[model samples]
Target: MADRKFALGTFNAGIAPFPGIVIDDTVYDARQVVPHLTVATLLADWEASLPALTAAAARPVGGGISLSGLRVLPPVTPPGQLFAAGANYRQHVIQMAVAHKLGAEGADPEQLAAAAAAEIDERKKHGEPYVWSGIPSSISGAYDDVILPGGWDDHDWELELGVVIGRRARHVPVADALDYVAGYTICNDLTTRSLVPRKDIPMMGTDWMRAKNFPTFFPTGPFLVPATFVPDPLNLRIQLRLNGETMQDSNTGDMIFGPAELISYISRFAELRPGDMVITGSPPGNGSHWGRYLQPGDVMECEIDGLGVQRTRCIAEAD
Candidate 1:
């Protein structure tokens, strides 16, 4: 194993975004080594390109450009299909339930906590993951500006660990699912909470597309760190700060369903292709819980260990 791990990202030197590898503070253009490889193509043939990418990362920084001032693009552009797990973190689910007064009304804190724990354990034993799809067009660069859509007031952030698939997979078992992953990245699953439930058709339940697929709703990547380098994805810390205040701070270990379980569950119904992303659910602590929804001119910084940081500025939707 190499002492230094490899990460892939897109940088805009001119007009178009080009695939590159970040080595420390400098970016070595992977196109220099494989001129025709786009980030999508690299992921499509991840196993074949691993050697070349590793070699490219080991090369000297003579031709590498400083990362400063370079515009970063979403690591995976036009990802094949975006999947998100909802209420997949034990604590997050508990927090939401309690905050909304779902079941624990008038119960003491101890009883509420115990009941939540029991429910989590029961779900782990027999519950299937709650997975939903998102439009690829919703994706934005890690450092890009997030547009707060007009008429929406409850935009909230859910920073999650994003798993990028390296191969086509269908009906994959949990034990073997991790083998299909290419790498991990950071994704802030922005949501418009007000649009969640369809009041017109209350029985129809949540409308993820309307709530999550707005332009620039999903802010992803600074880099895609290969799965091999991430020994334990569940052990990584996930944190999101609003402006300068820390809002979300938790670890992936709190997830109700880990990456392997999430992939296996989703692959049973959908054929996950190369460049398809499955965002493992965000941990507890979101604006909804704090009554601090996003406002224009706000800045959000999200970070996951080894996957790199994303800084996004919020601005009102243009007329």
Candidate 2:
């Protein structure tokens, strides 16, 4: 068996990459590092470029950004808007159902009932499928802090496998969807459950972006592992640790919808561009269950099979 290929943050000690593109405190031009290529383009060009990407992996290039010098940015620059699904996993949906039944204390009973009724109506209208959160501010590099904004006492971490679109896909068939993937990386869809004032805010309507997409809400990878390396995306393990203690541990197999299906399902309405990202749902272990929340100086680590680990520390914004 041959070795696999991966991309790293190559940066300089005195220079930075670019605005919004941060690596280990130093920034670099993403346009230069990430070839203006999509997943489909890479696959088509694989036969020829494979050797070069492989050679780089085998031999270290001098004067290049060392892993220590460059911080791992989210593998791809976020798209204009990002869409995420809610209760997409059967187990997660069931858990939320129970939590909703417990009811939110201090909320008006009649209003809560009305909200529940509305949710039932929407369920009849759309079945189990729902999408929400056009998160623009949530775009941040993988190593960036998963900020715990004040007032968010129920901050949580979700271990997810993120997929990057490599082509312009709209209404693509599931059978051909995998062809549009550029690669896969590890993502921590950090969220704050306290933002939803009432249980009535349907999972989709909770502005999950506010909880999930803080400035550095979505911390992603060390680097992207080309799709070719992931023969079975569903088989990968997804694990997360808080302050060096294992908090969540599960496999991608637990996802309600596989990557190919998610890509195809999302493409039906919106066009998935070369750099757009979709975070497949997370596994069971999250901070909420342990009654823990992110505090200043907290550290989080997320790792997925094939893709290496991404480590980040939570810090307050510079005054």
Where's the lowest-lDDT run of ten residues in candidate 2? 18-27
> Model 2, 64-172: lDDT tens per residue?
3435655444555434346665555544544454445535665564555555555545663465446555465676666666666775467778777877666678999
State the C-alpha lDDT per candidate.
0.89, 0.63
Assess every candidate by TM-score: 0.96, 0.75
Model 1 Cα lDDT, one tens digit per residue, 180-235? 99999999999999999999999999899899999999999988898988999999
Clash pairs, candidate 2, are 11-65, 16-27, 17-27, 17-28, 23-71, 24-71, 39-166, 74-141, 74-142, 142-220
- Model 2: lDDT of residue 194: 77
The Cα error of candidate 1 at residue 312, in Å, is 0.5
